[model samples]
Target: MIAALIALCVFALSGFGLSFWLRQKQDSSQPGEAATRGAEQLSQLRWRDFAKLVLQAMQGRGYRPVIEDGMPADGIPTDGSDILLERGGERALLSCKYGTGSIVSAQSLLGLSKSASLRGAENVIVVTPGKFDDEAERIAVPQHIELIDGSELWPEVRPYVARPQEPTPVPPTAASNIPLMAWGGAAVAGILVWFIVQGLQPDSEATSPALAPPAITAAPPASVPPAAATPATTKPVAPPAATFPSDPAVIEQHRRETANAISTLFGVDRALWSTQSTLMVYLSSEQSDPVNELCPLLERYPELASSRVQLQPPQGSTKAVRFKQCRTY
Candidate 1:
C-alpha cells in the first residue's frame, strides 16, 4: 500500500509539469497573435480616424502624404484609391480597407493596380487590417502591389511621424514697411481722386461760344389800312372715301402684313392668304384657340373683319374654326 501511494504522487507531478510545458510552447509559437488582435481592434475606428493614422504613418516614413477627400454622405465616388504618397519623385498609390472581417480579394488588388497605373504611381499599396486571401497575394505579386497588414501599421514604429512645419515669422523690418505701404497706397488713391475731379470739371474752352450773341434790333411797326369785308365764296367739300388698292402687289403686301400681325399676336404657326382676302391661320396644337384675342385686332381693319378667317389645326384632318363677325367702328 505504501509503494502504490508514492507512485500515484509521482504520476500527478509529471502530468502537471507536462501541461505547463505545453502551454508555454503554444504561447511562444503565437508571438504575433497579440499584435494581430491589437490591429483588429483598431479596425473598429471610424474611417476618418483610420485614414488620419495612415497619413501620419506615411508622413513618418519621409513621404509627403495626402489623404484624399472622401465622398460626402450623399455622394458616391467612383475612384477607390484613398491616399497618395510621394518621395523623391517616386509616387505611390494607397488604398485602405478598415473592415475587420472583410478579406481582400484578388479582384480588389487588380483594381488597385489599375488605379495606380492611371494615377501615374510607380508603386501601389493596399493597407488592410484584415487578412488577404491566397489568391489576392498571388495576384498582387505579379502586379507589384505591396500589401500592408495591420501588424505593420503601428504608428509608434515610424520615426518621422510629426506635424507639418509652421510658416516662418516675418522680419521686423518687413513688418514696419506695412505702414509705409499703406501711406503710399493712400497717396496713390488721392492722386487718382484728383485726376478724376479734374476730368469731371467742365472745360471752359469747349463751352465757349464761337461768336457773340446777335444784337436784337427793333424796327418801327408798319401801319396797315383797314379793308372792307367781302362776301365769302361758298365751296362744297366732298367727304373722304376709303379706297382699296387696285394693284395686286399692294394687296399682297397688305395680306402679308395682316398675316404677320396675326402670327405675332396670337402665336399662330402659319398663315395663308387667298386672292379673295380670306385668311387661314394654322393653330399650334400646344396653344389654345386664340379667337377671343383676335377679335379686338380684327375690329381695327374693316377689310380684314369683312374677309373670311379660318383657324385650322396643324393637321388638316382636324376640324377648322371660324370666328363670328367682329363689330367694326
Candidate 2:
C-alpha cells in the first residue's frame, strides 16, 4: 500500500516538473523584436564573418550551408549569391548590408543588391542596421527586396526558425501484412536455396561415419588346409581410405571466399578490394583519401577525371598483386 502511494506521488511530481519546465522555456525565450535587432547588428560583418553568420541563420532554419569565398571566380563559380541556402528545394539569397543611414536610394545598395536580381535570385532579402526611408520602402514591394531593419528583423527570423516536430506515435505489432508478406517470400526463397545448396554441401555426417577407424580382424593363421602341397605367394592389400577436408576452419574459409566472389561478380560487394584478389586493400577513413585526393588533381588536370580503373586478374599464381588505372569518380 505504501509503495503504491509513493509511485503515484512520483508520477504526479514528474508531470508537474515537465509542465513547469516547458512553461519556463517559453517564458525565457527571446522575443521576436530582440532577434531582429541582433540580425541587423549581424549585417555589419565582412564577407568571411558574413558567411559564418549566414550559416548560423541557415542552420537555425534547417538549411544546409556551404562556405564559398576567397576562391578564384572560376573555382567557386557562385551566381553572386551573398548568402546561399538550400533546403527542401528552397534556395534563398540574402543581401546583408550594415549602414547607419536610412536606405533612401536603391542605387546605394550595390555589389550585392543589383547583382542579386540579375543573377536570378528566387528570394532576395536586404538586412540593414537602420530602417528604410519611404523611397526604399516604396521600392521594396515592386522589386521583391525584403527589407530587414532593427525593429522587424527578429519577428521575421523567428517565423523561419526550424523546430523539431513531435514524432507520431507507433504501435508495436508483428502481424502486419507487408512485413508478413516480405517474411513469407524470404522463407520460400530460403527453402528453395536450401534445396539447391544441400547437394553442393557434401554429406559430412555420412563422411564422418565412414572416416572412423577401420576394423581389423586377426588374419586366419596363414594355412592352406586341404591343398597344402604347393607353396603359394600372395601380395599384401592396403586399407581403402578417402581424403576429405574435415577441418571446420578450412571449410568456413572456403565458404567465405566463394561468397565474396559471388558478390563481386554481381557488383554487390562493398569491401575495398582490387580486381586481382591478391592485393589486400587498405583504406583511409578520417578524410576520404582516394576520392578527395582525386578532386584536386582533377582540377589541375581535367583529363584525369575521365580515366577509369582497369580490372584484371593476376598474371601468375603470385600472392602479391598491383592495381592500375586509378582515376576520379
Candidate 3:
C-alpha cells in the first residue's frame, strides 16, 4: 500500500509540472499577438489621426510643424499637402495617406513634386501606411521626394529619423558686463574730479584788496541849449517784379529739371515728357512711388502750375496709381 501511494504522488507531481509549462508557453505567445495587433491598428488609423501622428513625429525630430486644414486659395498648386515642416529657413511639405492597402502611384508623386515647386518648398515627402510601387519609387528618386512607409514608421526608427536639436546659444557672461561697469565708474570719477577742481579754485574777493570810494565833484552850472531837430526827408522807390517764361519749350525744360530734382531727392528713377501742354511722368515699378514727393515739386515750380499731371507705372504692371494736382499749394 505504501508503494502504491508513492506512484500516485509522482504522477500528480508530473501532471502539475506539465500544466505549468503549457501556461508559460501560452503567456509568451500572448505578447507577440498583442504586438502584431498594435502594428495593424497603427497602420489602419484614420487619415486625420495619421496626420496628427506625423506632426508629432516631426516635432520630436526638431522640426517646426503646421497642419493645413483646407486647400489654400493662393496660386500654388493644391496637392493635399496637409503638413508643413520648417527648419532653419528651409521648408518641406508632407502628404499623408493612411488606411490604404494599395501601393502609392507615380501620379501621386508627380502631383507632390509639382506642388513643391509651386509652393517653393525645398523638400517633399509622402507618408503612407503601405509601400510605394516600383514606378512611384523611380519617379520619386529623380524628383527628390522622400517616401516613408509603414515599416519605417516604427517607434525604434523615430530616434534615428529625427534631427538632432541645435545647441542653445550661450548668454553673455559677467566678464562681458565689465566694460559697462567700467564706463560707469569712469563717468563717476570724472564728476568727482570736476567737483574737487571746483572746490580747489581760489576765491577772487578773498585774494584781492578792498577798493576805496571816489571823491564827489560838482558839474558846470550853465549848459548849452538843446540842438534843433532836423526836417524829415522822404523818398519813393518801386520794387522789382519776378519774371517767368511762357514759352512751351522753356516750360517743358523747367518741368523736366524739376521732375529730375524731385526724383533724385526721393531716390526714384522717373522720366518726364510733355504732351499737349500736359506733363506725363513715367516711373519704374522697381522704385518707390513719388506721389507725395511731387507735392513740394509742384509748389516750387510755376511751369507745372495749373497743368494736368499723369503718373504711369511700368508696362505690364497692374499697379493702379492716380495723380492729382497739389491742392495744398
Candidate 4:
C-alpha cells in the first residue's frame, strides 16, 4: 500500500510538471511566427555570431567538430567564418551566408567546391539563411556539395533563438498558491490509489475452501442406460467482400474542376493535380488552414471526397502538409 501510494504521488507530480511546461510553451510564439521572427534576427547577426549559429545547427544534424589550428576553441573559425565538420569518417567544410534576401551565386559555390577539394574534404555544405540563385542550384546538383536554404535552416536554429519574454499577469498571492494546489492534487490521487489497492486484496473473514465441508451426492442407478449423444452443428463461412475500382480519367476531371473551384477562394494562389488521387494547393501565406478553409469547400464536390489534398504554404513557413480528404470520414 505504501509503495503504491508513493508511486501514485510521483506520477501525479510528473503530470503536473508536464502540464505546466506545455502551457508555458503554448503561450510562446507559434511555429509560423517564430520562423519569420527568427529569420529576421538571424539576418541581422554579426559574422561571428552567424558562424556560431551554423555550428550549433550542424551539430544537431549529427556532425561533430574537427579540431584544427585555424579553428578557435569554440569549434568555429576565429575570424567568424566557416567551420569543419565530420560524420562517419567523412569530413565536410561548412560555410555560412547571412543577410536578408541574400542569394548565393554559382561562382561563390564553385569557389567553395575548389576550397573543399584542397582541404581534402569529401563533402561541402553551404548554409544560406536566404535563397540560392538558379545557377547556384545547377552547380551544386552536379557536384558533391549540399545547400541549406532559409526554409530548411529556420527549423534548425529556432530552438536556439530566445523567445520573446512577457511579464506574468498572475498576482503574487495567486502565483504562490499554485504549488500548494499541485501538492493537494497529488495527495488526493495517492489516497484514491491506496483505497483501490486495499479493495483489490483478499479478505481474511471470507470462508476458506480448505476449511469448508464437502457436499454429499447420490449416483443414478446403472440399469438406466446412457442416452444417445447428440450430433455437433457447424456454422457456414461467409465469402470475402470485393474492392471498388477507381477510374484514372474520372479522377483527373475531378482534379481539374476542384482546382478551378478552389482557386477562387481567398488567399489561395493556385492548385495543381500532382497525381490522379492527389491534389496540391498552394497558399499565398502561412496563415491559411486548408483543412478548415478548403476542406469544407472541397466537400461540395462529391467526386473529390475520396481524393487526397496537400497544402503547400509559402516559402520559409514551417507549417506541415494538410490533407483535405482527411475530413471526409
Candidate 5:
C-alpha cells in the first residue's frame, strides 16, 4: 500500500509538472507570434503609412531618402504614390502595396521598371503584403527589380509594428491538476489492491482452522446505581438559503470578470467578453488546444460556470468558431 501510494504521488506530480512546463513554453512563444498576429492590424494601415513603413525598411538597408524637386522630403511623392531611395549615389524606385488579397502581375512590374529607368533609377523595388506571379518573378530578374512579397515584407516591418504584451503565465494551481491526479491515484490504488490480495493468499494458505487456539471469556463486574436523569430541550434548525444574483448589472460584471480571468489564465492578449451568457475569446487559428485547457478551469468561478464559451477565429479567417461548456450537475 505504501509503495503504491508513493508511486501514485510520483505519477501525479510528473503529469502536473509536464502540463505546467508546456503551458510556460507556449506562453514564451506567444511574444514571437505577437507580430504575426499584428499583421492584421498592419494590413489595415493607410497607404501613406504603409509607404512610409516601406521607406523605413529600405532606409534600414543603408538607403537614404532622395528628395527631388517638388517631392516630399521623405522621398514620398505628393502628386504620386511612388517613393525614391538612394544609396551610394544610386537611386531605386519603391512601390508599397499593402493588401494581401491581390497578386502583383508581370505587366505591373514591366511598367514600374520602365518608369524607374525613365526617372534615372538604377533599380526598382516593389513591396507588397501579397505574392508575385511567376511571370513577374521572371521579368524582375532581367529588369533588376526586387520583389518583396508577404513572406519577406512581414520580417522587414515586424520591428515597426506594434505587438501586444502578454502577461507571464503563472504556475498551474492544485485545482488544475485534479483531473490527471485523480487518474494517477486510481491506477496506484488498483495496483495496491492487487498486491494486498496476493500477499493475503500466502498467509491464508499457511494458516489452518483446525490448529487455531480456543477462545477465552471473562466475567463482568457489579454494576453501579444510575444517577438522576436530566432532560434538555432543543429548537429545530433551518437550512441556509441559497443566494443567486438576479440583477443585470451584477450578472454582467460577473460575466466580464469571468472572461478576463480565463484570458489571464491562458495569457491571451485579445479582448474577451461575454454576450448573452456566452463568453467569446479570440485566438489565432493554429491554437486549438487551449480550448481544452480552458473548459476545466471554468469551475474556478462557480457563479459563471453555467455560461458557455465560444472561441472566435483570428481576424479575416474562415475557420469556424469553437464552442464549449463544462457542466456539473
Candidate 6:
C-alpha cells in the first residue's frame, strides 16, 4: 500500500514539473511578440525614399524587378526588391534594405538567405541605400549573394529606359535659352528618381536612441569582381501613345494644365493644346516640343515624358498629381 501511495505522489510531482517546463519552453519561443513590437516601432518609417532609389537601380540594369512589403510563406510574390528574377533560369530572390544606420546586421542577412534557400532560390541579392559593414559583406558573397550600395545604385536607378519625349528643334529665334519643355523634362526627371528606384518608410516614433557607430559601407569587396560597364547615354524620347480614356471632363482639366505648363515653360498664356476625351492632343512650339510630342522616345519603358500627361486623384485624395491621370488613361 505504501509503495502504491509513493508511486502516485511521484507521478503527480513529475507531471507538474513537466507542465511547468513545457510552459517555460513556450514562453521562450514566443519571440515573435518581441519582433512584432519592434516592427511596430519601425513601422513609422516610410522607407519609400530608400526603396525608390533601390528599385530604379535594379530595373536600370535590365533585370525584371518587383517590389513587395514583406516576404511570403510560399515564396511566390512580385514586389519591392523582394523580387524574383528569371534570366535563363538564373533565378534569384532579393531582399532590399533601405535608409538605416550604416551597420548591416548578420542576423538579418542570414535569416533572409535561409529563407531564400528554403524557397529553392538559386541566389540572393541584398540592396541597401546605407552601407554594409565588412563582416556582413564577407559572410554574404561566398554564399552566392549580390550587394549594391547607394553610389552603385544611382546609374541603375536612372537606367536610360527608352521613353517618349517631345523633341523640339532649336528654333532660330532663341537657340541659347533653355526651353520651357526642358523644364518639363526636369519635372519628369524628378519622377524618375522618385518613380523608378525609391523607398517608402513609415513614420516611426523617434526613440532617439543614439544609434551605434555607423557600420562601414557593407558590400562584397571587389577583388577581381566583374566590373560592371557604365550605362550608355541615349536620345531623348518622344511621347508614346499614352494610356487613358478620353473623358471630356478629364481632357478639359488637362487643357487648363497645358495652359499652366506653358505659362511656366514658355511664359505664354496661350493654351496651345486641346483635348479629345481624356487625351491632350496639342500643338507645341519648338521650345516646348520635346515635352509635348509623344510617340516613344529614346529611354526604355519610361514612366514619365518630356512633354507629359498629368493625372489627377479621385475626388477626395490628398493631393493632385500632374499628368498622373493621363498615365492611368
- Per TM-score, the best of the predicted structures is 5
**Inter-residue clash pairs, candidate 2:** 36-153, 36-154
lDDT of each: 0.59, 0.45, 0.58, 0.68, 0.65, 0.46
Best by lDDT: 4
> Which one wins by TM-score: 4 or 6?
4
* Candidate 4 Cα misplacement greater than 4 A, ranges: 1-33, 99-101, 164-329
Deviation of model 5 at 318, angstroms: 62
Q: Predictions ranked by TM-score, top down? A: 5, 4, 1, 3, 6, 2
- Name model 1 segments beyond 4 Å from true: 1-31, 66-81, 99-101, 155-329
The residue-by-residue lDDT of candidate 6 on 36-149, one tens digit each, is 333333333356544544445554555554333465543334343366654455656767775445455544565555456555567788865456776467546544578765
What's the best-to-worst order under lDDT?
4, 5, 1, 3, 6, 2
Q: Write one digit per residue (lDDT tens) for candidate 3, span 1-329.
A: 44344444544554455556554664566545544444454575566556666667766766676434563433122443446677777888877766446477754554565456556677787877667887567546545678887656545233433342222333467434544554545455555555655677777876666643455788877764555345556786778543557787887666665555444322244546566445566765636566666655555555465556677677776877556666422
Model 3 alpha-carbon miss at residue 298, Å: 65
Q: What lDDT is obtained when candidate 2 is compared to the true structure?
A: 0.45
> What is the C-alpha lDDT profile of model 4 across 1-329, one tens digit per residue?
66586658665875598558655654463555655656666677777777777788888988988888766677877665557788888889898866425787755664565466567677789887677987567546534679888667778877676663233354667556666766666677667767777777776655588765687788885674345344556888888643333786765665665566555444567788897668888987788654555565455456666678888888788888666675443
- Model 4 worst lDDT window (10 residues): 161-170
Candidate 1 per-residue lDDT over residues 66-175, each given as its tens digit:
43466433221234336667888898887777653567765455456445655678788777766788756754554567887776764332233234222244467855
Per-candidate TM-scores read 0.36, 0.29, 0.34, 0.40, 0.40, 0.30
Q: Which residue runs does candidate 3 get wrong by more than 4 Å?
A: 1-39, 66-81, 156-329
10 residues in a row with least lDDT, candidate 2: 261-270
Candidate 6 Cα errors over 4 Å, as ranges: 1-46, 66-81, 159-329
Mind giving the per-residue lDDT tens digits that candidate 5 earns over 1-329?
55566656666666566567655765667655654444455567777777777778888899998787888667777654677778999998887765435587755654565467667788888987667887567546644678887657766776766663333444578446655655565566656665765565545534678766676777796675455244455888899744657887986775664454345333233436556657777774445445544554455456666667777777887788777777643
